[model samples]
Target: MAEVYQRLAEHLDRLPDGFAPSEDGAEIRLLKRLFTPEEAELAVHLTLDREEVGAIAARASLPEEEAKERLEEMAGKGLIFSAETEGGKVLYQAAPFVIGIYEFQVNRLSDGFLQDLNDYWSTVKERKEPKTINQLRTIPINESIDSRLEVLPYENVYALVEAHDRFAVAPCICRSRAKKLGKGCDAPIDTCLVFGDFADYYVRTGKGRHISKEEAKELLVKADEANLVLNPTNSMLVSAICCCCGCCCGILKSLKYASKPSEAVASSFIVEYDEPKCVGCLKCVERCQMEAVTADVGGVRLDKDRCIGCGLCVSTCPTGALNLVRKPDRGEKLPETFFDTWRAIAKQRDAA
Candidate 1:
């Protein structure tokens, strides 16, 4: 039975987002925590490609009815992915552990499960996924960017939510995991925003509640005031946005140690320090979650490679010494749609 889960972990690692094996097989232990022996065996037979139950059963040599029942159960448990076509045909696919199954387990996650995950993550010394293929990107606070710059509608957080009719609010899975571990911060937990079909999934699965567009805007403001990083899905049409804290967010915490963190981020802008207006108050240094600001000979200095251009520092600058500068290195272009974003990611991950 343990060996079955070991194989399951290896199988999951081959997926696009990846689930690398940790030292001493901590990754396998985490898998065992999430799946039963039967479920583990069933999962190893699945692929990232979506397929009907009948087709999957044929491939696995299981009865169609049995396969359907098991697949539905796994989907409900957030161990697999399922989608309904417009004509009502249901399809199931293998889901990646982090941004997929682990996140979907919001409603069903237990303290024990979180502890196992924390243990597994702590044992892993290196990043599991490559930096260039991140699923999320940091964006500036809505009003922090200079109005003169040609900020695209998708670059603005407020416009992004207003463009979507469906909105849902869910607990921050990372914060929730921290809370269960008894080391959670005072930051708000229910700050994760989802949209369109992703919003519908959360609401339908009891993982989150439907929210109005107005309420979504209000949450973004509150999150900004709390110094949370606005990390939206890396897509022109974002499916979700996360209000992240450096202390709790897995992505930010990992990037803190990287020598070239900016290369990992998909930010459109970078923080610029105005030496002429600087007062050396060090407010921006204290406000930076990425540790990108520092008190130097000339008031403060911006670590161009460390800053993710989140604009949190700009909001706390009393003398207006900080501003978000559009990165000339980037062409100020984004994918036209979410499909394009996935296509680009697939190429990077070599899954295309």
Candidate 2:
């Protein structure tokens, strides 16, 4: 039983995000909490690409009916990814640890599970290799962008929302975990948005509530009003958007203390401060999640390197002292779609 979990952990570690082992063996413990011996054995046979039941059964050397039943059970538990084709054929695939299995466990989090997860996270070492791709990218809020600037459709949160037909709203899992530990803030809990197939999965699994496209846009507005940062998947065809808060989001919390927060995220724009137009209300300082703005004797000081271009400060600036400007030579172009983004990350990880 334990050997099966070790194999599963090794398999997961080969994924793009890489499920690294911890010093205290919390990774294996987490796997034990989430997967049974049979389930882990079956999971080791699965790959990233979705496969039909018969094909998966052959790969696992199990009878078709047994494989199907076990696969469905795993999918229901959010341990694997499943999707139905247009012709009503179901497909199953292995899900990564982050942005996949972990996110899918939103509705099923328990205190013991969270403790194991936190233990694993604490001992996980930072990647020594430079990141060539990111899972999420920051975009300025709808109210923050200057109309005169030419914004790409992908960089506009409203346009991304408009492109999607199906939407679902889920409770922010990071905040949920924080609240479970009695350490979170008062930010809205139901701010995470899923789209298209991912949305359908969330709704089907009872992890999230289906919402209209208009409702999703409204939620984005509400998130902005609540001073949450908008971070969509790093692809033009975004599958989800996270309305993150510095107080609750793990990504934001880690970046908050970093010497250069902007370097850690994929963002197209940066905040530009107009010193002459500044009224020293220090409103921007309060709205900034990255600690990018600070109040000085001479007025507000903008630390360009620390800003992730979230536009929270820009949207709420009383004197219009802050505005978003496109970065010169806007880094690498985003992947065309979410799958492409994953492939790119996989290739990068392989090369590394």
Candidate 3:
């Protein structure tokens, strides 16, 4: 075990400074509880790719069988993903929460850069604000995309059109058991789409891409025409990539990471739960992977202002017992600049 920890520390040291180890006091306790010293060491050495496993094992001086066995234990505890690959290969990736160091980056960046990028974002947001699941006048997800609408619905689930970056057009491909699932966990979101002043910088510098806000809106309109249920303002607020859940959406690879909160929902819809309507069928409780929902005397209780408005609870309510309502009061439902996405470029220039 000491050898494992020593080698693991060496592996951690080799990772780029950006990769944060899971060391929160609480997370530390959880890791201690969930993984053995060897497994924990292996967790520190893992990445999303399968090809890196052998190198990590060689670095640790452990036999491939030993490293592989330790990882399997972590997967059982949901600490890492060591799912099987069809070609007799083992696919290893960090579990979502363990992988959330990336989200922490976004959350951190949003705080400082959000204002600097606001002028351009403010306009892009206008087109996205009041993003409704059901637009008043729109197309349906069933018949759009020509006749490619098979068991899966849109280009998102359909492999051909999904890109990690819309403008840069990076192939954010997820592999399947047959074609090979991208991301491995099968998240419906091939990648989260981002649009802002910096997003354009991403494209030009190969840092990211400059996808016009209007063009994004057009994509949504096309999605609407296809009858795909699109989240309003979500592209602007949380991510540009529209996640397709299998149970919830045809994409976001819902089936892959449904059990893990970190890999599953990027942002949750915070809402209020009317216990009177909840029958304690645990429908909402069951659907809420976040454990944000709890049982009250009446039935289920919701923590408002914290919900990401996923509407999953409502969708699961056989009796419509749960509802994910809009939070206009908390987050300022309007951006105060609707229909100005076209001019976002000018805003960024002035900021620069």
Highest TM-score, which number?
A: 2
How well does candidate 1 score on lDDT at residue 217? 94
Q: Looking at model 1, which ten-residue stretch has the lowest summed lDDT?
A: 337-346
Off by over 4 Å in 1: 125-131, 296-298, 331-346
lDDT of 2 by residue, 215-234 (tens): 99999999988889999999
Q: What is the TM-score (0 to 1) of candidate 2?
A: 0.97
Candidates 1 and 3 compared by lDDT, better number:
1
Q: Could you tell me which residue pairs clash in candidate 2?
A: none
TM-score: model 1 vs. ground truth: 0.90
Off by over 4 Å in 3: 1-24, 98-352
C-alpha lDDT (0 to 100) for residue 174 of candidate 2 = 95
Cα lDDT of candidate 3 equals 0.38
lDDT: which is higher, 2 or 3? 2
lDDT of 3 by residue, 247-328 (tens): 3332333323345432233332234555556667775665553455767776876654334444445555666555443233
In model 2, state the lDDT of residue 250.
83
